[model samples]
Target chain A: MSTRRIHAWPVRLTHWLNAFGMFCMISSGWGIYNASPLFAFHFPTWSTLGGWLGGSIAWHLAVMWLLVINALAYLLYGALSRHFARDLLPLSVSAVRRDLFAALRLKLQHRLGHYNAVQRLSYWLVLALGVLVVLSGLAIWKPVQLHGLASLFGGFDIARYVHFFAMAGIAAFIVLHLTLVLLVPSTLPPMITGGRRETSHE
Target chain B: MSERKKAPPKLEPAQQTQVVNLQRRLLLRSGLSLGALAMLGGCNLQDGDQVDKLLWSMSRWNDRVQAWLFSGQRLAQTYTATQITDPFPFNAFYAEYNVPEIDLDGYRLEVSGLVERKQPWTLQALRQLPQRSDITRLICIEGWSAIGQWGGVPLRTFLERIGADTTAKYVGFKCADRYYSYLDMPTALHPQTLLALDFGQVALPPDYGYPLRVRVPTKLGFKNPKHIVELFVSNQNPGGYWEDQGYNGFSGI
Candidate 1:
């Protein structure tokens, strides 16, 4: 049997930072949303981050710096190191279709470090959503200064809806990602421990 | 727990090792859960908490950044008369029924701090200044906005008329309703900043801060104080009502 390192240090570091920062942003965002909800429902107090509206706004703005800087750093590292190209690229509808059926039958291969077609597609989608949410947030935060960005979303009022929906998309991805990790528990330890795959010869 | 403490002293060799492992595992589990709870609880900015202090400092730093980003020459977008929101919403910390009623007979807009002129000006005196009007949106912190037409003396004109120290860093307003707020000097001098006396070509109604209000299209609604009774120029930041509680002090839109 043999083993080798899979996840790199930068990847692990940025991943954890994003996890924590997103938690802060999303929880606090809910608190801010309750102040003037666009929808009929409100998030329960226990599920929110900040205790009140002012406190939530503070938390949201504070975490924004962390989330934005870390996300940028991860993108730079991913591109320079060819991580995205090597692991998550070349996604196609045909491949996704094949993987979907194979996964349903519990026959798809589970490689420790390699991504499947569905994983690649979702990663790309989440990345796009991240960009969307950030831009929408900026537009609304400084509508007068960033009027160009706000106009792209049809104005400040519409930009808010864009931000909310982007958040919802990311949240959906998180749920699916967690469920997959639990099903393939071996994938979890590797993300933390920089993954070592053991290949045995009979 | 008491039973386990007593057993540790008497357990045999194999049993003692098992007991020790059990205790260690329990301690690790509890410790991990406790850490998670603390992290979540720290999300709220508790008064005087270390996390709260750190967040406040970050907010203050952002205020500096936003101030830098603010451009005096840039203007908030203007809308046509038809685009103005009809029956604009009246929002404040208090209910509409609690709007203060000021007698126009004795109403005065007091000026102080760093100004050459100490005398207060009446509503008629304010109206005599060169006036301008704008139909612009007021973006609130609560994620809602409304467009309305405001006509009044340009704040820059008023400040210059009073011989205000142009270099002052802060312009604070004390309102008749006990609501107060302050603006960075640049915002206070912006062309769109108005000492608004008229809403939609009519004198302000009581519900909308009759007689006077500061209409700053460049700031969020809270920074545009209503029914202002006093205006002062100072180097010190007189923290605002919501700002002191936790909202960003700069709060530039």
Candidate 2:
């Protein structure tokens, strides 16, 4: 085994911070939603963060600053470092289709320091979903003041649905991401300690 | 035969015991780590703890941000009469049956704090003031919203007429139903803000605040106190029923 740099410091920092922020936001959001649910079913109490509606709102509004600031930092680093372009871009439909089939067949290659076509596409999609959730959140939070943003999602009522679906997309992406990490266990060390390549076998 | 050969290597009893011990250690480590993480996150802390204090301060910071974002000139969207939500949902801290019943003849709107006129206002006096009607959306903190046609005196005109200190930082309301809420000065003076007396073409039903309520289109519904009995202007925030319980004081929407 050899050690090398895989994930940059900025990437690791933002990744964990965003993880924490999203955990707070999503759990508290469930609490807030249960107050006057738009849908029929309510999120189970065990899955919720804050104990009550008021407590949930306090946590949600508080964590909002952290998430927004962390997102901005990630975006700036991704742009200035060309990290997004180098890692997640230039994805094509054919490459994704090929990778999808290979993955399903358990024939996909696991490279130590690179993302596959499917990984790239999923990362890009989750990033887009993150942006969407934040924008829709802002629209609903200040519908009258941010009328233009609210109207973009058809209106305040629809914006809530957009926020929910975007959250669901991000949650799905997280599940897929964790499953991949578990399947490719060697991938986990690099994310935490920068890199540790086990070169005994493919 | 080749596949059998590939699976020839098997763990001996000693090695199997070692693996079991390793798994047990891993589980214990993970359990401890999870406990530590939850503690560090302060998720289990009670109210008035460091976490709660931090959350409260952040909520207040959000209030300041919302206040800064507020504009006097930007009007909330208005709809036509036909667009109003038919049978607008009744909401309060209490059930509909508990909606306060105030005698209209004996009712007097108390005005105090920085106002030149300390006189109480009658329903007739408020009615006689120049009236306007607006069909605007009432957004609740609970995430539901409804469009209602509200008719009454513009709050700004009422403040001016009552000789209120327009420069006051806070305008508080005491409701007949014992529910209370307050608004920031900018919201208090917004042109769309109404001391609403009528819902639709007729007088406001008891369920909808009877003879008086605040109709602030820009704020979340909680800020619009119903069956208002006392109106006061002050430099200090008197806090609110829900707000004291931890809801954001300035919930603008």
lDDT tens per residue, model 2, A1-202 = 2443578889989988999899888988988899888799899866776566777777788888999999999999999998888778889999999999999999999997778899998998998999999999999999999999999999999999999999899999989989988998998887788775445542
Backbone clash count, each prediction separately: 0, 0
| Model 1 lDDT tens row, B120-168 | 9999999899999999999999888999999999999999999999899
TM-score of each candidate? 0.89, 0.89
Residue-by-residue lDDT tens digits, candidate 2, B107-140: 9999999899989999999999999899999998
> Reference contacts recovered by each candidate, as fractions?
0.54, 0.63
Best by DockQ: 1
Local accuracy by lDDT, each model? 0.86, 0.85
CAPRI class of candidate 1:
acceptable
Q: Assess candidate 1 and give its TM-score to the true structure.
A: 0.89
- The sequence of per-residue lDDT tens digits that candidate 1 reaches over residues A52-106 is 6777787789999999999999999999998899878889999999998999999
